[model samples]
Target: HEAPSPEEHLQARTSPLRIEPPFCQQTDDFAHNSTLHGISHIFPYERGWIKRCLWVVFFLGSLTFLLFVCVDRIHFYLEYQHVTQLDEISTPAMVFPAVTFCNLNSFRFSRVTRNDLYHAGELLALLNQRYEIRDIHLVEDNVLEALKIKADFHNFKPRPFNMREFYDRTGHDIKDMLLACHFRGTECRPEDFQVVFTRYGKCYTFNAGNEGHTPLITTKGGMGNGLELMLDIQQDEYLPVWGETDETSFEAGIKVQIHSQEEPSFIDQLGFGVAPGFQTFVSCQEQRLIYLPPPWGDCKVTPMDSEFFESYGISACRIDCETRYLVENCNCRMVHMPGDAPYCTPELYKECADPALDFLVERDNDFCVCEMPCNMTRYSKELSFVKIPSKASAKYLAKKYNKSEQYIAENILVLDIFFEALNYETIEQKKAYEVAGLLGDIGGHMGLFIGASILTILELFDYIYEVIFPFSHVVYIGRNHYSKERGQYFTSLRKNCLLICSHIYQMLAL
Candidate 1:
């Protein structure tokens, strides 16, 4: 070949080459070798124009459909749908729930000291005035006069009352109230019960397990397998002067609550009433629940931070919230409220704490952000009662207690609490669309619609990085290093393109 002149050489260098770019060759090779179906047909070398058009149309349509389905699935996953399922599990033994019982009449009239009676009557009168019960006048004027207090309902200021001392002295003794107690065919003593102050003034709880005591467990299921109590409601000790006007508080019976040891007793809200002259049988079923935390659920994974409680629960949270509200507004806490704050005097209770609690219930219930616990145990009960003290047993029991048959029949009751079965129900909240399930669904759809898999996706990404990255890097380097003239830029680009083609050709040869 003849050596070319400088002008000819420069023209040849700037001329646009007919050869396809190196990236175009790489793309063609990828299409032919890709595991993805229908790609090779779209890039066929010798196919007619009509066939090529059809293949392009079909591939793009299917690809668009696949993309739409994938997006829909992804949207569904992002919504974080959940499902709840119930399963029953048999257990060798179940922890016995805390059993708390309170007298309908908080104080025994005969047991009330003169000082306690005086203070209690004042407290009751204030409560009645606060609730607008219209029965405050029933409090003896002599007693009010003895305390040197006027009967003005609105301006009532109570004497300093020691609520815990008064309630403990006047409340029915557990030793006297529990005529008989048995657990699992063994006799239980009054010492086994712990004193728990509640809305009912002073109540007794069995198996509370809150003071580092070991929890009680029951292996057998059925009536009489757990706790059985013969209790005296002390009807004669219920005085009209100490009556409460609250609707639920007026009934003549004992209020009983079944709860987890971790939770405090909320007797007024959660207790069941068992009237005298009836043998009450409570059949309990334990339910254990597990819930997922966000984004699947709003359940809390850690115990809520609180000032009064060591464990977190809805009831505990509400109690803490109420204590905070009361202390913030009234500078004191209620007797049943858990806190180290000074107990609300009867006057403060009637004027400020009571109204604050009512407001909390009526309007500010959502003020406390009590999230559901991720794991919780709950007890559900079914109650059945049979008339106690039959004609034959009434006289026999009356002789044994030296009381009238009528008194025996009216004042005594039997309570039986036992598990319905040793099996517990588990209710779990689970993510219906987990990440793994979503990825599996995506893979299935890809394989079904586009004949692609994880491997195919990886191959495509590899092809892009290998081809486009080097090509882009070369163009960036040429632009930065070459002359500003358009022809010089084209000449640099042509040289880089040739270099890429030579490398690709050597790769193919290998």
Candidate 2:
């Protein structure tokens, strides 16, 4: 063989060699046919353009309908609703066991004026006596710090009452007043405020000129002692206890009014995630002295069973039980507990408190030791002010009392509270399957009209899964082993041959 000439080499360099791509080239007829075959495996029923369009429409419509059904009926069945009418029936019984002064500003009467201090001091004394509060240590800064540290009845959240306005209207420094009453000073000594009671021989008197007396603070729907008050609420009536004041004198005269309501059908007393059915609406809408159905009675829950309560009166009792248990076991009382319980310092708590306290720290449920108190009705209250005249004014004395003026000009602030049956509804909250039932009903409708069942959903998912992941070729156990790269090609060839032979056999038979 002779070497190629320079002219041949120049020709080779100038004229580029043209090489065809693999058999699956984009424009090739065989490539197109193979693609159609693969597509046919995915969609066996799809044929022409019109058939493909119809299939697309069918798929979109079916998807839209399925989503609509799930969104509508599934959410509807998650929570239950029961109607309540406020006439000719007894309302649920509620109790008001205790009250909390929520705002730090409400305790600053000493800084405001001497009269404010005197009145607030006397009121603080009365409150300590009534509630048996051990200390009036108002958390001035980061009030929630203690609440964050300890789990107790005081932190039982989502309280039905709105105290924002109560504190806003009074704006009395309650902690200062307690200090004035207990320490007879401007503020309490950090060490002196051990128990919040009137000091021996220290009785503060409020002499608000004869025209006015220190705003007589009282409550209804709460158990009363001496000048204290509570309401005898019954069926069909929600008690709103508010303070009536002389708008002219700015005196607070708290009153309790009984209003009628239609009978309430308890939708769910399982109070875990469920709200106080009617109470939430009544308060949120500020619908005092008016009878109305719960506005949200027909509304569907976005996230079902969402309402919750962190603590209850029974929870307090359980803490007392736990305290008793501690006293029995370790001979020390926890400082966080209410009543005349002795304070358990940090060292004491560490030395004496059970390891169970650590266990129960952030848990949602109450004590496992003590069961809920039966026959005890629980109440929560909202304080609202209405303009009215002091009943102590002269309209009734000329007529003997000022009933008309009292009705019109007196500042009447009401504490509206409704009662509910108390029990452990946390863990035991039963789900109301409204949506599931609706789905079942839909299934029945399909069966009656279109011969379909919920199993159709399973079938649809299975079809989609098969399309995404088609079955692989069946290999004979003793066949030759092949590398992964060549195995796929060999399987495709075998499958194509089988299809062709089957087609030919059918053609021959025909």
Candidate 3:
């Protein structure tokens, strides 16, 4: 071959086909332009090793702090903490709460039939003896003796009895008990009250809103502006057979509960007592509560299959749970419980249902897992009382009712229920750490420490992926066409060698 010139030699040595690794060039460009703090300083040729080391130390310290704080924040968010806040709002008018009242005496002395009395007395005696309650003195000594003989003859096993029918037949009538009624300076009739069954047997609820009637509203507060009632709680008509183990019910009074129109009344458990011979005033404040569900709180939304109640509440859930337990164990339901199961007869009640209910209350209460409702309305009440039938009007009242002053004083009470103010209190529970807040905190820490944003983070990931997995044909050194097998073999060998060297360098650095 002829000797080549100097130009030809230079051109051949610096030919475009002469291959060089592109990774180093690409890395240098990325470092110069990247938004990551200290990256360009680490790679630049002019920076001294000492200055680069200092920058690396500072960047690494900041990154360590950021990581620690971010980890703590993430852990806190996962814990699902909550906060409750209370706020009061004023309103022009507020819906009056439902008022449910029941007589302390569940049955009339003269209204119960002999057979009904005997069966009820036997059941009561069995219950009192079984539960170690007070002695049962419901019937006369002669009747007691006869009951003992009958019990011995039948081995103390009770017969079936209809408790619902008995209660309906002998319970106090609303017409007779509500002697006077007024609402917001207007007269209210007994027909306006709806009948509801509760643990206290028959009870009456005003403004229940169940008969397609809208709830009553009040624009004013204080006594005489809401519901006013003069009730006759006839002490003389109270029968010993109707008393419960709890001595609180033995006193002559009316049990009253203030609740939402959509909720069912649990009178025996939630009611306050209004004693006869007193003018009782109940000042109520409406409260609306909103609670978060699941990961944030234990509150539950009302399910579509809520069968017994129009709305969901803790009290309603408890009642349903108890009813289900009773039906499952005893195959019967109580008079106060709502279900399609047959009413628990006196025999079954004494034998199975009562004990099951007791067990549920005393030991297995946790079995019912009734979570609170997410949104609910509640009433907080403040009560005050003044003695009624003043000395000046005692005689006139006695003459009008055709009863003695003592009898009137012992049998009559005035009840006034009104709002404390035309305002509603809101209680709300909220998440302390939300997803948005978490992301914000993380972003703030990232920017403060590494001088990086979301876009910078994406750019870093893209750079890494491109470096680790380049195109198959990209590893070739020269532009000479080769067989596919040869190209693939060279590509694999170069990639393996680069990865091995990178790993060795990382290990040595560590």
Candidate 4:
């Protein structure tokens, strides 16, 4: 054939059909630093098929492991984030003690004009005119107004209840009235100590102290009321009625139950209601009040001045202490009328209420600073009625209505008055879940179930970094340059082989 031109020769060498091994090629410096060369150091790409398959398996497994970690992390965040959020968000526990005062039986009265004996049901309707006792309709319509009567009959109607009508409707069943008399006279006077009144006086001048009604704990119900009588008595105030007795005993002939309606818990039991719960007391044929076991024996309570805080509220002892602090410091009292300081006029009270209230707020911020007085007496009452002849001999009646019978029939009414305290629920902070323990549990479960560890995560990140960052070391030579190198190698090999065979043939011919 004619000698091929340089261009034609170059084309023939560079053709795809050329036969040559890759090692025979002369490569540039850039080619030596190519991607395949760098990848070979990290992973042997030229290995047998079995090794290649294994490498692919390892790569895919690592990717799956990373995916598992991602999923686990997402789950952990979703699950444990609530603990952090719960730690930040809190609400005051509904642990305030609730006192429910419901009358068990209505009073019976004799009619003066008609000589008729009255029924309890009739008395309930008439009492509704003076004070809402049984009309569930009125109570439901104006619960706040109805509850106020339980606290104090301050808004009683101007017209007195028709005594004749009252007597005609309830024949000598005066227990409900007696309850009203107790609450009405909760703001007691010195004369109240002399005798339990058949009626409460309408006087604003008496400052007998909270010697009437001071419950350490109170609830939404205020004091309960019903068609039955409500016996309202303070253990301290009714000491005379109980006679010279350090301790007294009587049957609480009515059902006693706590209305807290809270989830049962140690924290709830501490401040929510009475411990061991409440039960019913019965009196069969007795009609008198007596004392019971020494109340909250040996329990410590912060002593409060009953007279000093009579007007503000029944449980105004904390404010009383704060007011006392202000008086000692500023030499004045605030807006609390009937407080300890007689000199605190309206003008002085106006000036001091804000500052005093602020200081009280700050003082109460201290942990357990205004805790329930451990020693203060709490009051509760059991009311019941029985029909015994007015002229029945005391001994014969006592024998007939004996103590055990009195309990079932609830003739000997016993009132249990105690100071409900906050010894248990003073601490406000409670955890919905412990955060640290949850994290540990998740981590432990992951290790046990999936053989995963924190080290596995670090290794996954390392593999990703190696794969992406090593690209910086790789060099790219164009496809044309590689093809040209291969072509030159094959062409030279053919030429050299031809020269060698020609020399060997000449020697054989000689």
Task: Order the candidates by TM-score, highest first.
Answer: 1, 3, 4, 2
Clashing pairs in 3: none
Cα lDDT listed for each candidate: 0.79, 0.31, 0.79, 0.34
Q: Candidate 3: where is the Cα deviation over 4 Å? A: 1-21, 124-161, 241-249, 302-306, 469-510
Higher lDDT: candidate 1 or 2?
Answer: 1
Candidate 1 overall lDDT versus native:
0.79
Give the per-residue Cα lDDT of candidate 3 at 482: 44
TM-score of predicted structure 1: 0.85
Per-residue accuracy of model 1 over 263-369 as CA lDDT, tens digit each:
88888778999999999999999999899999999998876788788888878877888789889999998777887898876567667877778777787857766
Across residues 161-231, which tens digit of lDDT does each residue of candidate 3 receive? 68888778778899989789999999999999988887677889999987679999999987778999998
For model 1 the local lDDT of residue 363 reads 76
Give the CA lDDT, 0 to 100, for residue 233 in model 2.
13
Q: How close is candidate 3 to the true structure, as a TM-score?
A: 0.82
Q: List candidate 4 segments past 4 Å from native.
A: 1-49, 55-101, 106-410, 414-510
lDDT of 2 by residue, 113-204 (tens): 22222222223331222322223353333422332232232433332221222223333322322211111112223232122111010111
Candidate 1 clashes: the total is 0
- Candidate 2: residue 376 Cα off by (Å): 7.5
- Highest TM-score, which number? 1
Please report how far candidate 1 places residue 420 from its true position, in Å.
Answer: 1.3
Report the lDDT tens digits of candidate 4 across residue range 334-435. Answer: 322235464443233335644565556565565224433332222233433334323344355446544233332234333333222212212122233345
